[model samples]
Target: MTLLSDQMPCRYVPILAIRPAEMKALEELPEVDKDSMLPLILIRPWLSANTLSKSINRFKEAYGETRPWLADIDPFYAAALANDDDDDDEADPKKVFSEIEALQDPANGYSNWCAFIEADPRAIPCLRLDPNNINALTQEIITFSAMQRGICLRIPRAGFGGIGQIADILNAQNVTSVLFILDFEQATMNELSNAAAAIGLINTIKGKIPGAEIAISATTFPDSFNGLKEQAIAERGFFSLIKAQLGQFRLIYSDRGSARAEKRTGGGGLPPPRVDYPSFKNWYFFKPEKIPTYQAAAKAAMTHKSWEPKMKIWGTQMIERTAKGDPYAIVSPVRSTATRINLHLHHQLYFDDPPLALQEIEDDWVD
Candidate 1:
């Protein structure tokens, strides 16, 4: 049954990693169980560490007191929990054996947990017919491990006095997932201090969120395009060097671009003078030619199911040409199996201004 309307905007970005807990949460919803079902059980093939970590947290919170049986919650969680309680960081041989034995016990009910597992995230399931798993990241794939204990990290705009706090949150014994929002508002291109700060922040957070991937969202860059570019290059370098990192990176620009005084065409019956230098381009808005390399770099920061990687770049759709007939810095995704599927689904959903058949979601999971 389609509990969520196809017409409804998905609360989360479907392209990014979906946590098993998020999926499990859907199954446990009141709508799914008319008969007061105990914890819902799902049987599936593969569960990514990202999915398992988030699922554990979701169930941990949603089923507080009335803890439902998450047969499929990460097998390691029980051990991790037990280990967290131990004062010494070193593993005790007997303690390890006890946890393993407890899990093996039928009374403990930690075996063959079920959640409807269809697609394997690791397999980089092809979206449709494109034959390439282009949408999957090639680097650290963000998962729930970054936000263990349901902790969320919001870096402050002020001097990062909160770095200690962020470390505290990331170091939480139960922390397995994190929603790391890198606030670059204070970033100034004139000085590398902000850039240095960002590098420091990322280095500190690395590998702190265990098992699951981290979700990175950057607010904005500097005032000048050069500053933005400098910061972007620096950040790209930092993540490239780090072996352990998050699953996804989202760049949300505060403004599209600062207005520029390109000489007006036909102003007072005068043609604009041709300029040698092209207009400025920033990370947020840039030439389409840059999309492939930029997206590739962004995806590089993520871990993917396949080495042959693809990515989806979303921004303002450009169709019209300006009076000068010069094209705007229009950005778009490259062709791939995933892109085809996205286009097919988009056409189906918004083919009409107000779609006629939105009441029922067409299963676009298949081509």
Candidate 2:
């Protein structure tokens, strides 16, 4: 696929903690976090305006590449550091370059830590205790928050506190529905604890925002998950993790090709890994080879002792079923609130079924 397609990098889906609707809204805003945007600009020096072209050109001439970070000077810093002279002219690109150069130059003893201090000295051990520094840092954060209005919310993998921060913002924004995607490629206790806590926070806020729904989509690996077997094992782990934490689905929709999002390309640098997933198209979302695994996982997740009559319809069906095949089933959680998170684990394959063709299967089918 293309290095960067029109599609949002798939890797970010789980990071943003957004739902389908919110994801659509984000596509309109096309929010890019400062962290992600900065790196992209830094690596692709040509993205910078012509004013800084000279500095970029010079850097390219010297280092055989344009310094992407130097391309578009941070408007925040440019305005912060601008001269107050009555004559209004663009900030001197050369001076701007020099400051950034100084900030980056290790020869000047400006290590990353020093840059951090320079950017927000309040974070320093000594300064952190100072009220003035704290005030300044708070203001900086607030200002940064305002700047993020149009950007996608970039959720950090930091523990509970970080997740809490995300919760507060989403709640304030009246974002009720969320999809938390867990990338367990590199699992750890701390990470797991933080994730669980994050879910708890989401649950806590559900009372404030009525109709709030949160679902988790997790991927995991087993001792041996290579080639064809990989799909089944991954789904097993995905279901098991969610089941271990939350429990069974309230209702489930099992179709092979429904949610097999496009594979992602690893991120180039600091931003979360870039992904290349398919957009909303009528066609199957997953690959054709993985149908059996998806069916197996769905069967496992939706298994009930006996087909309860209530298991039939969870909510308004999103798609309609036809004689050709069953429509994808809708999966529901035991509880609607965040307290009982729902997990949708299935094999990764593209097994397209007719709209709303889901049939009630015996519990033994899943067992």
Candidate 3:
């Protein structure tokens, strides 16, 4: 029941927002890409009880197989919602409780996690080691570890100082095998100090929990592309630095699937018409200010050197169709997001491999 091993081709672990567009991207991923990566899906807080109920099923359907993956309710969102005293109907704490109950619950003695297990046994639950939640989380970890499915400890940048305490909790629960996700939400490696600090933390975690699998997760994707045309994929550079120092210590690569690390709040205006293409190191962004339409954006992207017509990727297919005036593929920010993410996933999975050729000949032909 090992989640990852030397024999597997698992290279990327994308931290995805559990939304329709992201789900569509996952659903459309090629089997080869799916085989090469694991997805750590974060359930956003805005979902209602009905949507929450459908999310796990959606995830299972999109994955198309009972493969190992991680699931966690957004801890920041959960904490904020739980502490909110406002009368906002959408931010109701009861709704948050229901959401928690559907995913993982400590209030009701992990009844929710048990039910979640019944729904998708392949899911590897993630726990955020918040001090306030540690007591409950310890019990949850014990329960999950007893199942022998493994547990993911999602440690935010701020949680590094508490590593000793976290190790004690794991030790007390007798949970030796674990997945540590060092999440740097909306943070980047623009500074050398940040990279050094991250490496140090990784070393500390490895020292505490020998042989534990670790993943470095972060995102530099901006919340708004305002007045911006391109952004470097800093997570790649950061991961590269860590890998250089660690050598072959089984550290997994993770990012936000080219989506913003921090969820944006408010703003009802339509998103700018843009299409983003991911290269080996940077994201080539296209936004047609004059035309202000997805068709124009797609057409503009086609002119970029990064756009490859021969690539059989789902995102490129959408862009090509839209550029050629396909109405079905043109319209809405949701479709645009899905297009970008699908491409990002493909690029990350095949970063070191050649592009998957589009099948043009019948395999049944006798030579």
How close is every model to the real structure, measured as TM-score?
0.27, 0.27, 0.87
The digit string of per-residue lDDT tens for model 2 on 1-367 reads 1111122222122221122321221122211211121111121112344433443343333223311121112222333344445453455444444454444333322243143333421111111111223334333334333322111222223332444444455455544333222223233223443335534644554445444333333332222212321123233233335445655322111111222222234645432111111111211111123443333333322232321223222211111111112334322211111100111110111112312113442322110
Q: List candidate 1 stretches off by more than 4 Å.
A: 1-151, 169-173, 192-196, 206-319, 324-367
lDDT of 1 by residue, 1-367 (tens): 1111121222121111123323322322222121122222221212343233344344344334232221322223333555566665455434433433333333212121101112121111110111122122111112223211222333334525555444444354454433343433222334322345554565566545433223222212333333122224222223233313333532211110111112113525421111111111212322223433433322322222221112121111111111123233112221121222222222222222323212333222211
Q: Top TM-score: which candidate number?
A: 3
Tens digits of per-residue lDDT, candidate 3, 1-367, equal 5443431346788988777788888887776667668788877633454446566667777786657787777665676756767766576445445566355446644657655753666677776445567767676776777677777777777787887678777877777667788888787546422568887777887777786788888888777677877777888888887888878776788888888777678989887788887776778878988998889999988998877667766777788889988888857888888888888887776665644434332322110
Candidate lDDT (C-alpha), each: 0.27, 0.27, 0.73
Q: All predictions: root-mean-square deviation over Cα?
A: 21.7, 18.3, 4.2
Clashes of each: 29, 19, 0
User: Of models 1 and 3, which has the larger TM-score?
Assistant: 3
By lDDT, highest first, what's the ranking?
3, 1, 2
